[model samples]
Target: MPPRMSDAVTGPAWASPAGKPPLSSRMMRATWRGLPAKRYEVGWEPGLVVPAGDGSPLITDHYFPRAEGDFPTLLVRSPYGRGLPWSPQYGLLFAEQGFHVVLQSCRGTGGSGGVFDLWRNEAADGRATVAWLRRQPWFTGTLGTVGPSYLGYVQWALALDPPPELKAMVVQVGLHDPYALFHAEGALRLENVLAVGLGMTYQHQGMAPFLRATLRLQRRLREATTARPLRGAYAAALGGELPWLDDVMTHPDAEDPYWRGASTAKAAERLRVPTALITGWHDALADQTFEQYERLCRADCDTALLVGPWTHTSALQQGWPEVFAESLAWLRAHLHADTSGLRPTKVRVHTGGEDAWRDLPDWPPALTGTSWYPAPDGHLTRQASTDSAPLASFRYDPADPTPSLGGPLLSRTAGPRDNGTLEARDDVLTFTGPPLTEAVDVLGPVSARLTVSTDTGYADVFTRLCDVDEQGRSVNVCDGLGRIRATGHASSQVTVAMSATAHRFAAGHRIRWQISGGAHPRYARHPGTGDPRVDAITFTPVHITLHTDSTLILPSGPPLT
Candidate 1:
């Protein structure tokens, strides 16, 4: 049965005790009890049992409470230890806003029991955890999940099976298809995979031991300058030899089971709950998020999407306040609770260069007008001229391949910045469009249709959608990459898909398309040798022929005038 909402303006559930003080008051008491009265109190309790599926134990940390009276539940399932500053710092703020916050380590990581194998165990454990939460004494039977990256992935996975008690979700910067993300365009994501392995190892045990081992390895590497010390450090810290790393380094093709296991598209179709999907214009998983929204929209599910000018890690620290407010309002409405008058479908996206937020009823707007520009002499012009021009070509090398200058390369840092320096390199090809006579709002996925051929049998195409101002500074709006395989004399006509964005191209600004062979270490180079092994780095020249029939398509929103 659905829970009933109290009609009172301020029910007993929202009141605080007198004299002894409310939880927030007590928190203040604990904080300023000894020091100056100005110190803020943020109470957090570590290692609270949450009950595993079995009779054993599942432990999670509880952050801040203001006189708990069956408050709504906010669950966060993460591979990273719950004690990490990034997780709890943001978590306590939600508690302060009236919630019973719970942050649990995924099975096989931190204090949780079971072997860790990424998404393989998240669904079952998540189901068990939610079922257990429904029976908790303090639970109001209203629950919602929130997190970014791996934590966000677990929310999506649990929604695949969707517990009856689970109300809503806020998934931030998580991959929809693991294979496409981890092995984009058939190239192994070497750094991402390694970072995940290293992160799990440190979180499984704790940072102390991992830090010691890493320090020792760093010292050894400084002394030896060889790959052996680094390899040994990773092996020791991860507690096992990563044979998959070697596989990724050896196989540049996408026919392996390892790549397939990393994909989450199969699980996405099962998602049925109301979800607020968020991603950054510069995030590596932006493509996956956009694809998931498009797929879920086609399925006719209740889902809203938001794209901002931030990266994966930045969402929590810099973008959380606004995001969390919307998330909480969504949860409140869906759970049949009062939201204090907040709309159900509100989307605010950050526009690059301008750094402003634009609110809309729905993404891609209700009325979308499509515009196609023809490619002549590598220039994108709106006027369709039948002038035949020489094909544009660029050579890609594996050794000193394009370096990843920025744009959603996840690290310990937060926020989205510029990648323009990398975009100006020689390997990248630039095609500019004429300046717009009026402001044009673009919202949704941008795509490029290309009719091309490569001298070699295999190659990769990198495309970036940018906004070039009158001053000639190009800011990256959205980007995508695609790998193509040449089969004999077959035509190489393919569509390069870019990440979705919400932006208003100013009156004097011009739209531009940047085509290249690689985005560097962010996305591994496609060596062009067609070798199945990732470690076999070979360089080959591939002549690309871009036919005049090729066109760039931009999905624009209704006129904002």
Candidate 2:
């Protein structure tokens, strides 16, 4: 079934007298523990029509507190329709909090009239909505933008040519680079691509259709993911041809003309808006949020960041309380000149193993780089080996590719999960460190430099950082993938940049570094024949060798002497 908006929280609270605020509005405010609502009654104007740049009708909904007073206006543009989650989460909830909220559907979605063309139409359509906003007598002349996922993309689109009324932005589990979303390290991210197709094609159509589509995708996932010549493989699951998905899968190069202007990183570089970013440790776009935070800092834009222990969808569902509080505080600070609720620090992150929140002046506080080398005997040690003897080996078959478990996926299976079964696979290599006598804190970026050789010149290296407990349950922390194209029988040195994290390897726990050829579905399996994975017709098994000189680099809090 399609996940419902009310699944996050429940309330039996009654609405205000005269049924002014509505049951949904009262339930939401009571459900998510956040700032107190400023008003008990909310006025809603549904199905407001606004004109797009090309004269198409953009459907919108307006929400405002009924009490007398001008309030800051927030513009939310979404491709996922203006119902359910969007209506209750953004439209009604924020309205009760004293902000005039404008919730509009993107061109061609919801009731909007036009052809949806992905990122192409957002900017012009956003500006057109703002143009429509300026004409409203109750617009207040001050504006902010707030939303999660693709809704965040539209904010970046508008910031490319920001209107004068724009002041603040809250991007929750946001996306700015479409190319990176589809491909990672030159390989297609097959499952995520199909998930996106399912969302865009069926989600906005409403509950029943979305539930059917989700079930169809689940039933046909394996067939679609393993199909030969995969360009049109997702048609069965997605219900029809999605030309855009086919186009993105075929164009693997980010620099190609097909994706020339896809990234909105430039918007961050030039934006002077006070932006607040919210993401989960396992969010699929957590890396993108980090990149955005860094760029905003370098540009000297007033910014704040909040990282939690959740996933892409959970950042809005399970993590909604913290997410909403942080967003409301930032918006109130910038748009309403109210800073009482703001935190003292600019960055706040949740430490995983310790399960505590840490506030810092900046992300990735200065930390010492610790190197752990992999030994031939399946051990992880600080000491480097002088002789490269006892080379570790494995065989990866594309016909039976390595399965992806958890961590940073867009589905329900995302986030931290036990990796005991995954590590037992013959195709995977693991190096374990001795149980720690003292707690070790890891607070920043994680990377791996490996010396590897494969029988086939074309291959991919999937490296992951895991924490194994006393009972021997291995759970993933962060991981990354890199493709290697080398000459026959020659060793290749490659660096895999894993996702950054703020975690604690508790006392009595061991650290493990895992290496494999690929993580299927999360990333399309390499053909091992130097051919594009989408177009490759032949599958080959590869024998991979790992040398002792490889090391895992971590940003550690204290020296582990």
Candidate 3:
């Protein structure tokens, strides 16, 4: 049983001078664009201590509208510190809109006590926070959770054994599986791992330390990523040794006991709480959001999805106006019991190339599958090739691995990027279709089926879907990487799931299928020796051959006329 409301010892409230909005709050309101002026001034209470399940102290801050009414409460648990963007964006902004927001730091972060163990402590700490909330005089007995990225993961963690007060949830650019974030197919996602390591190590210390760490990573990323033995290679860039980082980097297999219970995807399988999901086309966890939505729909749970043209970080920065509005609307409908601001559609996606927002009854909306095959002279044709020869061949050298420009990443360099210079490289093979006579809208999952043989028998295939403009500049849309082990020099048929997209390929633009051995740094260069990436010391160069029978599969509306 939980303690009574009066049993908790809450610290003093920290109001702004004369109950006025701070400069940062004013700036956020101006820059957030579409949001109207807040209805009330926000009151803040900082440095409140809540007890975790194991009696450890978890530091927290409270934000509320300075009005005379009882409002629903919102819970946001983040590993990132309670400062700057989070304090202003979620704490003050949402509170001013008539909700009591409790912004808390997970154990071992933001002055909280105890060692942070990634996904292990979240569930228990969340339940303990709610137990504390139950004793707060202003808790209102109604609750909703809201946040982005790892913060979103905390929401799912709490949902695993949600309290009766938990009613609504908003997950923005979120990830459910740490293993998937680090390893794709069989290759390690080197860049994302390093970026995450930097954040986990320094972001909680302070702004100065985090900025310095970011610069350090920027300066030494190449050295760290290209190191001979991959294990412990990121220590210089990340500041120091992180045992968890070393553990995750070394364990490439998902089935290993090390990764057991890492994924929180099961929480959504039968969730009854109303959930609102927001993601970007280039978000690292966009596919996870889609999978969550699918599971919610299958369970007949109320859910809404919003996908933008922004990246994981941009979904909160450039795309915040839409993301915030969607979140607020959902919270109001569920927690406040106000449906006036709800949209009529179940899903809203911003279409690229067309630069317009489309509201649909569902995502992937009953689309047709269009198949494009590779042909001679670097062309992509609608008909299959009967030629009995290899379509193209390229040599991949681990020493000078293919550079990854863009697509999906956690860093600022994510999203669609021009592949002109990259396409000019000998290691990349591109087969382009003719100029589209009519517009082609790609609205769902994209895949590449290829038959390829490598001299080393162990290699990775990087496939990308690109939109080529009149100037011959190819911009990547969605892409995927697959690791394959061939048998006795026989060609292997590998299908790479390039994720999904909601984009328009305007008339006169061309569609291209780009293939390469690997996207270095984005994915660790395959050593070509079938050894674990972290322990492999030998780097071998391999010749790869692509057969003409390969095809690109896209989900679209109708075929080009």
Candidate 4:
């Protein structure tokens, strides 16, 4: 056994201001809490240009603790510009707690020179950066990395072939494949992908108007939704061409060879390190985070998972003070092999409907496969429907598709939001369940099995799970989309795998499964003419018919009486 780290490394020795618990606690270690906002003096070293494997100069920012003596180094690589990472209580605060922090701009962003390619160029660049850090006399022999989203992606890319100096990593809201970020079930993620692309364009172009245009999408989303055919609107938003966006528009298939170069699934196969992961229930990458955590644990790696009720950006803010101190504990225990602030391997998730957190030995909590039958007239029941059960039919016109609503959307209003407005659309078909007499705990992955016939061979399937209270307020739980390559007059089975979630439908609350032909701009309308969305400027209306074979299968914990 290793010696316990001194109290100084524990952080409670440093008295925090009144009204707060100890600066750090063991509970925070098990659960992810953002590090506290305590004061500490740190020296900043900006614009430390380093060479990549290809000899391109990568711009980096390094921060050092004032009282440090050859402190361990932490590296963060990003394409979201280096400025925000160095802001107060973020990058600088990491240094304040005794470590040299390095925030680098990947190739083509910030001061780094090269064309900005979305997933490409990260692995080689990350490897070169870590190698350079090891040779620096100012950096101690140990090195760890931290960052979120794109920053998190870079860490997985490096773990594919980590250097000996790389000891620990902290990845938040990351993906194993680029497809999870832009494409799902052969459908383009319209609004979210465009925002990311436009934001990237703004960063590269650095134009005030372009930046404003990106922000406008969020501010006047309803107005922005008016832009037609998607391709033209996204291009217009940037006021110019964005190669990354162009690639996504052209390569619509998630399994295409084009994405092979950047898929983190390849790296996940070789991952071997002490890793800490944090995610949010409503986050777009929540499912992927859980999948990655499961993979790591199966490999016998030291991994911890934390899922809270937060959006992509607000994930760390869920419990900021406790998280900050917990983050420090993660770094100390992993890098120095210290046991003082040790944390166990477990899964901690936030139950949305219940609005509480659960610590379990593993995720997917021994869920039973429960199937809810779709009653076209409106009801979800466990008892199989009779042949006399009426079939629900709604005409799906591409010209007027159902609009986007709250779900795991990245760029728009994400998290749990009222869906009453969206449910009123004529193009959407709703199947409701009777008000439950007892609370039902719905946990883990959800999938829908549908039997449907369409007038046209091509169509789209959009499904949503919502909780409707007695007051008549409907809020989104989880949703997913599946594209029908071709359909016929005969009923065909189509399956849509909704994202995973941990929610409890309280007593008196009704469950809903919304069936729609399209979610409009968020997912491109199936032109109904058999052409792809890129050429979907003009589309023909197709009538869609849904039959009784459709079922919403939810993974639930204990069977309800």
Candidate 5:
């Protein structure tokens, strides 16, 4: 008996006024109808289960349509509640599509009965959940997982073990590495941390205990006007055994234990199942996704990476429809269904400024060329010319640190929008290139080479790559910051890594590089002292120098004529 399409499948709610139905919902329904009809006779039954794990009892909300036959299952394990509108929508969509959807609440949050420990129980619990699903009568012995962010994290974790029943996974904006994505360049990304924490608080509601504790400490510090008492209270509340925070403060350098737990680079290589890796250029986790894609490619795993011109939230609000459609197509192809029109072994990137998409065989087209070096007198030339004068110097003060006007700072409302405001500060030095002869598309890694000297042993170097319009308004294309300790500096040239961007510098648009000492609160201000954490509010005037031979390298392609 083939499953009959329900009225809900044909209603306006499922299909838009346009001829095409909503991708997300329609795909789910289509998957259901595509399954063998005999399974439809067996209805689904709901249940909950606690996996055998160390942390807490897992709570799984099952949606098996009471039918007569076994059906393939779709699993979504989330820190967010299983009953949330989004979760149910996904479950219902999958169930209607022909697979039993199981939505589970992670340990300690939602309806689960255990203490939540971020990444601690994800692997073990995921395995246990899969094993449980395999035993259920409604299960057809195959399982797939899909989700974004935290949910995506679970998929990656489960894939590490190569679960027997796990067939495929769709991971979106998942945190591949926490260290690089969060505490970047040895600075506390306060804004993004707070935004994620607050959002989790609202979703889980179980974070009330931690919130109460944090609030209590905040009130105590506020009342203590004196620096000594405030410092004491703040240390007690935020310092010491706090694993996550301590990891950031202690390991100012990138590759630490804390960072290892957050990143899935190693796990990605070990994964064997087919995977769909999705991310956005505007996502803070874009670097992570790109890194994972590269790793998977090197490992010779079956994987597809999709990058769009969207932010973290935009992917879910608007991008998921397209994402889901492509995901289903991928699944159908691998599942021996259909893949007639899909393109293979190619990269599709959104060309900024032009606001159009282009397809290429490789990430950065081989046809692209680089400008040798720009001369000091604002000339774009191929020949290398040295500055007769000494290096350029700037004074960096910790107290009056340069504030981050806009960039990647995370906020409840929205992250940093544009870098236009930060370009106006005096502390930031700008070097501009003449208008391009034609449109240049830069789509990969950006690097800055600098021979620099700082009066203080410990200082941070920030570089921003931007585009200056004819009106002289500078817009930040991409930026990267590097923290240099006194011990790491010796008269040698150093390179700082900045965020990646995909932008086209118009023929008349000048390419500009803005260098500064700090982006403040978005990043913890470098006290310019040797100590990692400073208690006293001291302002140090550091003499910073950038040599004449320095260069900003852009991964650009041949001019689009």
Candidate 6:
């Protein structure tokens, strides 16, 4: 639904770009230092019980400007300890901007009731909370939602069939379909899954014994990554709280009915609010974030996007001030029907190598496709080799799988980092192109096609795009992985749709690509028996061969002229 002028301003008396400025044009880090403290005195109302659709009460903390008389509400639904968001940087900051802020802990976390089950319980709880807000005297009947990651997921859950009071939203680094994005092609993201699953386990539980429990859960997660029968590894540590974890282990495939019900995609066309979609290049959910942004834009909603160089956590911390400023500006213009000086650049992305932000007409630009084929000398060239069935072979042993290198990740190691150590492994094969005489600006979608044969009926193919610097250091840019099941064919062709990115490769840098059997603990290694992470005894070495015609598709796009 597109923004309708009649819808925003009625109940509460009715409501509501050019490209954004270059990141370098700003005072740089000075903007972070010089920002004034929140302007209003903050007041908090705690342990407010808001009844849900099931008549269960959810615990909430309401923060408001001390001198306010009925202001717009900024609602943030999160599982992260409810108290953590009541600080100056979160709820209070928004309250100071002439908005009433409510930070509510999702069901089963913090003071709320029920067992927290990831995406399963959000939609009903979110709708109930919004209904509760409508009854509050301080609520001006106009609302906006904000948060990142799981918090952002709540906004998605709520916005699917948002109440008319919902006027705007700011969501960062989250997904519409968890299964589709998290377990792409049925290859589970092991590192991200454990890190987040365990992190969520510890985020809100209280002190003393609970803290002790948190520590135990963390240790169990670390051990589970290396342990066999990964399914029930967390049961002993979590006790009753292990159901959600078990559900994650059992449902490794996408399109599972369990994940379909939790998605916000069903509400895609109904998201009529003015929304700001934010993400980082190195964030693991970059693919989903952009996909959702495009979905909203295509639905004709008033939407904007901002991409940064930060990771999932950094998007909230190091980038909070900017996120705050932009979010406040956006909500004020929408929820209040006040559009003063609001020129929203529809798409804003930060170019990594160039270290500058640009406002684009749209994502995946007006770019042309460029294909590179695998050559005999291990060179990624424009010409395909006709060397008569020439191939590259590697042994993929599940016991000692090729490790995941740095890239768009959510685990222990993320962001832009050197992959020199990773490239040296014998199990990994790399193809490189000659140095570019001039800068090569690449943006949008990237993909890989691999024609290979596996000795067994099942295997996984991991492909990564990299930039090799003039000094011979190769750093991961984007990656793609897919699980393949043999259909009794001699050799099968598999295509992996990679993550999206906007990067400028400087002159003297070479384009590189790496292929391996798996990105371990980040992605579960395939067990030759066809089922993965089920047991230890099924592990076997699979002989894998890549035919000469495999290609890399890069969005080399039209010139910037």
| Highest TM-score scorer | 3
- Which portions of model 6 miss their true places by more than 4 Å? 1-37, 206-222, 235-241, 338-344, 386-388, 487-489, 557-561
Q: What are the models' TM-scores? A: 0.80, 0.94, 0.95, 0.89, 0.81, 0.89
Indicate whether candidate 2 or candidate 5 has the larger lDDT.
2
Model 1: per-residue lDDT, tens digit, 189-217?
64565555566667546557667645654
lDDT of 1 at 357: 73
Model 5 per-residue lDDT tens digits across residues 7-80: 12332221122222234434444443223232221123333665746645787666543333345677888876
lDDT of 4 by residue, 1-561 (tens): 211223234222111221221123222333433454333445566677999988899998766655424467888887766653233444566765667788888888887987778888888899889888877767667889877778788988888888888888887777657777777777777776776776665553444545687775556554444455556565555566776677887688766888777678655555787888887777888878888887887788877777787777576555555445556778878875555765553777778787887777787778787888887467777777665233777777877777777677675477788887877877788888899888889888888988777777678889989999999898888888886655456557788888888889998988888888878677766777767776666777877777776889988754222
Report the alpha-carbon TM-score of model 6 versus the true structure.
Answer: 0.89
The sequence of per-residue lDDT tens digits that candidate 3 reaches over residues 1-561 is 122223334322433322444466567666666774676666777789999988889999888776655789999998888886788889888987888889998899999999998899999999999999999977778999999999999999999888999999999999889999999986999988998898888887877989999998999999999998989989888878999999888888899999888899999988999999999999988989999999999989899999999998899888888899999999989998889889999999988888899999998778888899988789999998786458789999988999999988999999999999999999999999999998989989999889998887988999999999999999999999988789646788999999999889999999999999999899999988878888879989889999988989999864322
- Please report, as a residue range, the 10-residue window in candidate 4 with the lowest summed lDDT: 13-22
Error of 4 at 370 (Å): 1.0
List candidate 2 segments past 4 Å from native: 1-38, 387-390, 559-561
- C-alpha positional error of residue 12 in candidate 2 after TM-score superposition, expressed in Å: 30
| Candidate maximizing lDDT | 3
Q: Once all C-alphas are superposed, what RMSD does model 1 give against the true structure?
A: 6.1
What do the candidate models score in CA lDDT, each in turn?
0.63, 0.87, 0.88, 0.72, 0.62, 0.74
Per-residue alpha-carbon lDDT of model 2 for 1-561, expressed as tens digits?
111223324211221222243455557656666445444356677788999988999998887766545688999998888777787788887876668899999998998999987788888899999999999877779999999988999999999989999999999999999998999878998878998999888888886889999999999998999999887989998999998888888999988898876788899997999999999999999999999999999999999999999999998887888998899889889988889989999999999998899999999878888999998679999998786543799999999999999989889888898998889899999999999998999988999988888888888999999999999999999999998878977889899999999999999999999999999989999888888999888998998899888889989864222
Task: Please say which candidate is ahead in lDDT: 3 or 6.
Answer: 3
Q: lDDT of model 4 at residue 337?
A: 59
- In candidate 4, the residue pairs with backbone N, CA or C atoms under 3 Å apart (3 or more residues apart, or in different chains) clash, namely 33-323, 33-324, 34-323, 34-324, 35-323, 35-324, 35-325
Clashes of each: 12, 0, 0, 7, 21, 9
